[model samples]
Target: MTAVQRPVPLSVLDLVPVSSGSTSAEALRNTVDLAAAAERAGYARYWLAEHHLNPGVAGSAPNIVIGAVAAATSTIRVGSAATLVGNVRALQIAEAFGTLTGLYGPRFDLGLGRSGAPAPGAPAPPALEPRDDEVVDGLLVPSPFAFRIAPGSRFALQGELLGRVPGDVERFDDELALIRDLFAGTYERDGQVVDGTPAAGADVELWIHGSTGGASARAAGALGLPYGANYHTSPGTVLDSVRAYREAFRPGVLDAPHVIVSADVVAADSAAAASELALGYDRWVHSIRSGVGAIPYPTPAWAREHPVDPAVAEAVADRVATRFVGDAGHVADRLAVLQRVTGADELLVTTITHDHAARVRSYELLAAEWGARAARPAAVEVA
Candidate 1:
């Protein structure tokens, strides 16, 4: 078999939005426009994120957003950078993307996350609902229920349970088995149709997404899914989580275990311009450190006016140091190192710049930069 090339596919992790002063409708429109631009710019894929209760994050319903993006762009893939699986159920998710697949073909990827978006500074929840459960009758898909049926009586009685059911449930194996069976019934060979459409291809590429290791890696391995580590905001786990994923992986549907690391990136005409755009992200990070709610990207003037705490600013800088930034060449060099370090089959770039046009330009430049890097040979083995 031919070895996979290094400096892999460059993709965008978009949180589509208007600039700090723009409106929501405009943001949504801009998102569609941006996805189309990325497609034209030769980016491999454009993935949106699911963030709830944050005015700053416009891509809350990734599936809906993906639909818009996919519809607007012909060949560029559109996916969820990470969808909180706990908020949505498996059948719905399978159906949602299955429909997209039918519409867009091989250009859909499902990046699944377990935790909900917590307002910045909010404590991580005591418990998180896992993605695997979201697929079967175990956890209800996040969409509004189809009908007004009382909770446990209708669903549980019909031998279908959505969301967490109480009590002494079986172990992971049992849960996986049940989930598999349900998906099989809904989207497998003997698939059924709801509202007159067939359900098949639940075999969609499922990606395990997270900021940590252990359960996420083990679960993804056991289920034979791809894994994505959130290196953008959670840089510490970039390598360890990928290592765990590869070690725990067993060959199945995927030829081999693949890891995608998310990285924060900002590119501009000059180093000064890039750093200026990064100020918003730095402020966003500082707010996160102070336990303030997820704050909007500050204006260049605003960022300059309000200096962050020295410690907070340093912490932001350190985390972002792992980020790819600067003019195209500077950022591309960093991407090469990152792609080498994590053995990511793809690099998912997330830019936190508050300027809408700046954000779009940054991705366009990175896509062009990485497109050339992808042509060269580099070590593919995980470092």
Candidate 2:
């Protein structure tokens, strides 16, 4: 069979999930192995997300995981799907990403997001002063409902439930500016210039990730950086966020706007098989939404046997409804539509399942179908 020609490039966003009966060590190894498979399958990039205090997630430190994956895979771009910028100092991020780029060459990206993860018993970092002037002109005010399911809500709830005071989420824009300047070797403190050394001269792509069409989108547009909308996390605002990014875009590093949309998916040889693989998704989502950290990924049998409260079900309905689950062809068709609707330059897929082999197979099947579809011949010739 001919490979499907995709309308847009495809990439992977892995959480490095620790399965119901698996150890973190095993999860980490699985991540490296998956990266290698994804590279060989022709995926464009392999990114890991940052999640803290979550028993089910082992990607707490994305930079470190990125290094491991980059070393294991020869060509696929590797980096954080997003590093919570508000959690650490800008200089640290610069140095870390710089080192990765220096070692791996240009195959590294730095995708920054707004929230921070505070460790238990640690005081929250002080908030940077609000900059009214930082607001971009013509930016649309997002809907109130947008906040309800936005990624920030999850980050805030995670901190609250863990009894940890998180850093100022509002400081993201300022931090972004600092990081850019640091990377460019233009940062200055008082009368002295601050340098990021190896990182300051490293070549790395910068990206801004957001779930809402507010600050994050605007910031990316204003800076002319690539914007990634989190359709997987905030389905309701994905389009809005992408639109916002394009609207605020200015010609800078990129001559035009570029957007990457993320989606949660599960694919298999048969629809029934795919559905089985996605069975435990709702329970896992419920754990995160419930303000209790994510639990170990449950098996399909465990998810089916464990009763779910109607309220819990309702709360995670959006996420469950948004996830794409089907056989290869079905999922490939859906993703094509997603690419068209968002006009995304690329699509990032995040698939989680109990069995490591099944998870890898899902990506393999989807990649093949997507490639085939993209390369299909037109039915009729133009006159």
Model 2 lDDT vs. the true structure? 0.82
TM-score of each: 0.77, 0.86
Residues 1-383 of candidate 2 have per-residue lDDT tens digits of 34433468899999999999988889999999999999989999999998887889999889999999999989999988798875666778989999998888889989998774543444554433222221122211222121222334455555555454434566688888888888888888897888678778788899999876888899999989999998788776676789999999999889999999999999999999999889878889888766567888999999889878888786677678778899988888778778867878999999999999999999999999878766777444344
- Model 2: residues >4 Å from true position, as ranges? 1-6, 116-167, 190-192, 378-383
In the range 1-383, model 1's lDDT, one tens digit per residue, is: 34545567778888764356767678788788788888898888789987654455577678999999988988887788776554555556666776787777767777766543322223333332222212112211221111122333222222222243332121333433334444455324445433313225444456778665656777787667788887776565455577888888887657688788878888998999998888766667655444343466678888788877777666565465566679999988777667766778887888777777888899888877777766666545554
Candidate 2: residue 288 lDDT (0-100): 77
Each model's backbone clash number = 11, 8
| TM-score (C-alpha) between model 2 and the true structure | 0.86
State the RMSD for candidate 1.
10.2
